[model samples]
Target chain A: MGLIQRVIEAAGIATIGISIVREYAEQVQPPRTVFLKWPFGHPVGEPHNRAQQRAVVEESLRLLYEIDTPGTIVDLPFAWRRHDYSAWDQPAS
Target chain B: MGISRWKNQLLALLATRFPALAKKFTDSYTPRASTGDIPWVRPAVPLHRAKLALVTTAGIHHPEQQPFDMQDANGDPSYRAVDGDRLFDNFTITHDYYNHSDAGKDPNIIFPLDRLKELVAEGKLGSLAATHYSFMGHIDGQHIDTLIRKTAVEIAEKLRQDQVDIVLLTPG
Candidate 1:
């Protein structure tokens, strides 16, 4: 996934990836990423959890604009199935 | 299903249930290391004004499309062009490297197209690209080169042609 991100970014389009494995992101070094210590299949969040999914997408998109350094992986604070996503306010720009 | 597919499915299930086992599995496969400068592109527009697209390595495709090649141990590096507007009408997942039962129920967890649409409606996002891309995330060995040189580049060109300003990638 990080590999594809690199190719796309190299083509001049901004990219942000949601990575479940930090090690792979560290190795492939995609331009921007947000890491979640979640399970292998769930990158955004749990199934049917709209708020959680929205939070992940919002934070990731926000970082795409804010991250100036290449290969920066922001460790997301949301815990798998535990974080209170309903309270997640969209981060200030 | 072939024995390799069955084995991979079992491993995926086990890994999803056990984080320690998941770590071991990820540790077993080393992605190609970064050798040179990493690629970088700053966003050209704000969230509410940029055109967004999704690219996922989650093995999702239209049911009529060819399923990913699961018989190969190295994994398939090809991609599926997903129609963002009609994907939820019917879809299929062909990845054995991860248990996708939950994703099968609500693919928004991996693809999140529905959530993105909601964002567009609420004016938090600008719009979505008509076409998105999907690939199985288990590519390894020689297929990695094919992905980096061929398939990924093709998708990037397509995104460029579409005038996409930003992309959000997801994994499975």
Candidate 2:
């Protein structure tokens, strides 16, 4: 993802990323990033939680201009609502 | 630091130094990339006025196109273009590494096109590019090189052609 982000950036488009794992994001070092504690495959936020999802996306794009320097990661301390995770609770296929 | 912390650091250093200890680390580890000279071009327009594009490595594709190859031992490095304005309810996930239960429920959990459009409407953003992208994130080894060198460049061209000012990469 970072590789592609850099490619687009080099083409003169600014880029920002939302990362669930700090390790990978730190490795490639995108132009801007928002690190979230969301689970894998849920980078924006939970399904159906429109407000939280929209907020995460908004903040990530906000980082593109808000960041003064390249390769900056805005680590966001976000917590997933502790509901009975329906996905995990699903009957196994 | 505490004595226990010092011991753990020492062990980590030894693992990097000695093959014997490295083999016993018992987890995935990668040497970090040197990014001193990474390319970055800031938008001339503020994010609120710039056209936004969303890209994901979540192995999602429109139901019409072919799915990513889950059987490839080297992993699939291919990418698909998703029509941003089109209804994306039929989009599906095809990767093997990460669990897709939630994404399967609502792909906005991974792709978030709906949320992005809302942002655009609310004036929190400018506009959505006509095209967004999807690639399989589990690509590894030589396949990953192909992804970076070939597909990434190709997509960059598409984004450039679309006049995208900024992109949001959502990785699952």
Candidate 3:
């Protein structure tokens, strides 16, 4: 996403990326990014939550004019409603 | 138990106790590098009037478009052009790395096709670009040059042709 984000921005089009992984987002910083510490494969939110998805999109778009810094990454206020992390059977360390 | 869960727990514990050591340990194996220069573009117009488009790395493609090649272990770096005029009825995912079971049921989770159109209807966004794009995120670094040079150039042209003002990228 970072690579493509850069490409689009370079083409004179603005872009904002919603990232599931903060590590990668920080390294390949795009012009604007929404960092949702939510688990992988669900960047927008859980499967069919329309309200949450719309809120996420609104917040991301809001960053377009709110942020002036080139690589600003604002962490969104959201958490997984489910405690399950997919590897529930794995022994806890 | 798989090694990944254990590793993640150990990393989390180390991060709390020995922060420096934890970072070193994590950084040792996964040396981070920027994919390309981050280019900045100020919005020429207000977002409500700007043309918007969606992009994803979840390997989403139109039902008729050719699916991403997952046979190659190295992965495919190509992207697909998706129509942005309406909500997608169905999308095919060829990415094997991510757990897309739910995405199969509802692609808007990753692509946000429905949400995008909703925003347009609400007049939150000015308009939707004529086209959108998707790519498989599992490609190896060996094709980084091609992806950045060739594929990116191609996608940029499409965005330009559509006069897109803002691109929302959903990285699955």
Candidate 4:
């Protein structure tokens, strides 16, 4: 994604990334990146977690605004605690 | 268990069972971190309503592009392109590495184009470009980077030509 961002930026357009793996994405460092501590696949917080998801979207947008230089990453301190819910194991009704 | 903790336990077990594997994981582990700056000059005016596109690296191959090569299956670096149809139906991910607990969900489990389109309809995005893109992530580092860069360039060019504003990369 950072690589893509670089290419997009080099083409003279603003670019950013939403990295599932925050730490790894930071190393690649696109012009702008939103970091979610949530595990892979659930990048925008999680399903049914609309508030957190919106917050993530907002934070991601803010990254575009708050970035002073390229390759900026804003870490949103949201964690996915699937263990809190045992219903995950039950079959869907 | 937390994924991180599970990873630790898995690593420990691997070490206990296969010392060599443990050494390998320990040596190759790259901790994630936010570091470095990407050199970019924002558009003259930041894109207020940017169209978004998605790209995936899930080794999804269309029957036409190239059949999944079992010979190259084990350690093949090159990846095939999956036709953007119902190709994802009955999707079976084959990679010896990485945990497969998330497999068998929705093929979109890897590439969620429908979800993106949903957001587009809800006006979360200005527009969803007609075409979405994908690539197999398994490849030689040089080839992977080259192919990814080439694809990104093409996508960016086409999007720019089509007046696209943003691209959201979904790496599975």
TM agreement with the true structure for every prediction: 0.97, 0.82, 0.81, 0.62
- lDDT string, candidate 4, B1-172, tens digits: 3465456436544543453563464345342223444567654434345665555544444545543332332223344434344555545554333333343344444455544544555655566566555554333434445544576677667667866666555444
| Residue lDDT tens for model 3, B1-172 | 3565356436544543443553454354331357555688798889779898888888888788887876664567899888765436666776655566677777777988777777778777898887888998755656667777899889988888878888899975
lDDT of 2 by residue, B1-172 (tens): 4564355346544543453654454134342354577777768787568888888988888888898876664668889998877737577777655567677787888898887777677676788898889987756678867877898889989988888888889886
Better of 1 and 4 by DockQ: 1
- Candidate order by DockQ, decreasing, is 1, 2, 3, 4
lDDT for each of the candidates?
0.92, 0.73, 0.74, 0.51
Models sorted by TM-score, best on top: 1, 2, 3, 4
Residues B77-123, model 1: lDDT tens digits: 99999999999899999999899999999999999998899888878
Model 2 ranges off by over 4 Å: A82-93, B1-32
Ranking by lDDT: 1, 3, 2, 4
RMSD over all Cα atoms, model 2: 10.4
Q: On a 0 to 100 scale, what is the lDDT of residue B109 in model 1?
A: 91
Q: Model 2 misses residue A22 by how many Å?
A: 0.4
Candidate 1 TM-score, C-alpha based? 0.97
Clashing pairs in model 4? A23-B32, A23-B33, A31-A71, A71-B38, B61-B82, B62-B82, B62-B83, B77-B139
Task: After superposing candidate 3 on the true structure, give the runs of residues whose Cα lies further than 4 Å from its correct spot.
Answer: A82-93, B1-32, B35-37
At residue A51, candidate 3 shows an lDDT of 66
